[model samples]
Target chain A: MALDQSAQLSDDALLMLYANGDPGAASELTARLAPRLLPFCNRMLQDLAEAEDVVQESMLRLWKMAPDWVPGAAKPSTWLFRVASNLCTDRLRKRRGVGLEEIAEPADDRPGAEAQLIQAERLSALDAALQTLPERQRQAVVLRHIEGMSNPEIGEILEISVEAVESLTARGKRALAAALAGRKEELGL
Target chain B: MTGPNDRIDEFELDALFEEARGESPTPSDDLVARIVQDAAQMQPKPASSEGHEPTGVFRQFLAAIGGWPALGGLATAAITGVYIGVAQPGLVGVTAAELEDLDYVSTEIWPSDDLFFEEG
Candidate 1:
């Protein structure tokens, strides 16, 4: 398939093409999914390197699973997110003994605009606050609020009911607010 | 005793989430390249005619007879039958002419005298 045509294809369609050994399909899938997946993994793992690893592993699994993938059963992106979510959970479980403060903060490399710096700081604070949340709540909040996914889709990714998803996000937001309560003045919120 | 004034409101938290959304980390080019490479390495090969040609008649016949070993066994059995008929080895040895002269049609399989003696 041509690159343009592959770009226009749906994730399920691309996966089918990939199973049939179309080289273009893999690249198209990577371009479509990697960007979305990386940040979600990064948020979950709180480490860019680990997040990158998770994304690569998840995509590898997707490639292996392409042949057996049922087209209408689930969206490919949802499946990918679920894989990444479970991988992140496993990593987090292994990290139980590690302190959150010990996780290295990502360096800011952007050109310094005063407003941009403020925005970055606020986001950094939000990320730190997010780490304090329970894993399920953090996942729900990130998927619902930051990723702008619907509750039903977040439920699917987290393997929970939609009502449970709603409850998680609510509790997660409350925890985040409490964690960041003192920083309101400093963050200029 | 956390006061209400100390807590960040819902609006403030929402604004922070909005910032976080806008500031999602972009994947490094190296990471993207690595993922694509993995996909390439792991992908299933396409269904193609090259390795999947239709079963030929010879192959079907071979399969039906349970392949080369069975064929060898059958050939051996056939050669032995031919050897026995043509060579006629003299181990216990009735000659071919005597064997041919033996009457087959008038031979009684069960003799009446033997049956009457066994009954008595």
Candidate 2:
């Protein structure tokens, strides 16, 4: 099938097609998912290299499970995020301390010289604030706020109830606000 | 503590989330390649023409002799040969002249007289 046609299929369909031996599906899936998953893991782990490893490991797991993948059980993207999130959590638990130096620099390397640096600093500040949150709270906030996922989807990823997701996100936002309060003037928020 | 104007705080938080999202870096080509490699290695192999191919001796035999069709053809030829040999020996018969030229067999009586004698 053409790459364009493969791109039109939903994530689950793409994965199922991949399991059936269409290499195009794999390309399309990787293109569509990796960009999103990378930053999610990066933010969660605060280390770019570890985040990359987690993303790869999570995708590997997904590919391994493709043959037995149940179409209606869950969306492929959701399943991937859940896997990536879990991997990040495991790494986070194993790390001694999340030093500021360990966080990966901003990923966007476009030509806007000074503006780019400022954006990176602002992002680093936000990541620092997010790191202060409890694991579940951070995941809830990232999924709900940053990724723009619905409460139910966040719950699915976090393996919690929708209400629990709401509570975690709410508390997470308050904590983030407090952490970033000192930087409001600098961040121009 | 929940403040009186918490709605404002929520909106501000939303803006912060948007900024964070905007700053999110796309994965590097190297990382993407690694992921694709993993997928390539782990993806399941396509099943045979049949939905679920048989395994064990039958499967190995089919594989050994090319595929199922080849094995089937071989078996059919063998069975036909066996049937012809058993049910119609004349189909493969050698003529008397041909048999006479063969020194391995003797036309003259080679058995003792007692061999043909019935119990008397």
Superposed on all Cα atoms, model 1 deviates from the true structure by an RMSD in Å of: 11.1
Q: Which candidate has the top score in lDDT?
A: 1
For all the models shown, what interface RMSD does each have? 1.2, 3.4
Candidate 1, which CAPRI tier? medium
Cα lDDT of model 2 by residue, B1-120, tens digit: 534433236677677678888888788999888888888888777767447756799778778999978978998999988766545443246677887888775333222333334476
> For model 1, how does the per-residue alpha-carbon lDDT over A77-175 read when each residue is reduced to its tens digit?
999999999999999987877855566553333344243346667777788788889999999999999999999999899999999999999999999
Clashing pairs in 2: none
Of candidate 2 chain B, the 10-residue stretch with the lowest lDDT total is B107-116
- lDDT, candidates in the order shown: 0.84, 0.79
Report clash pairs, candidate 1: none
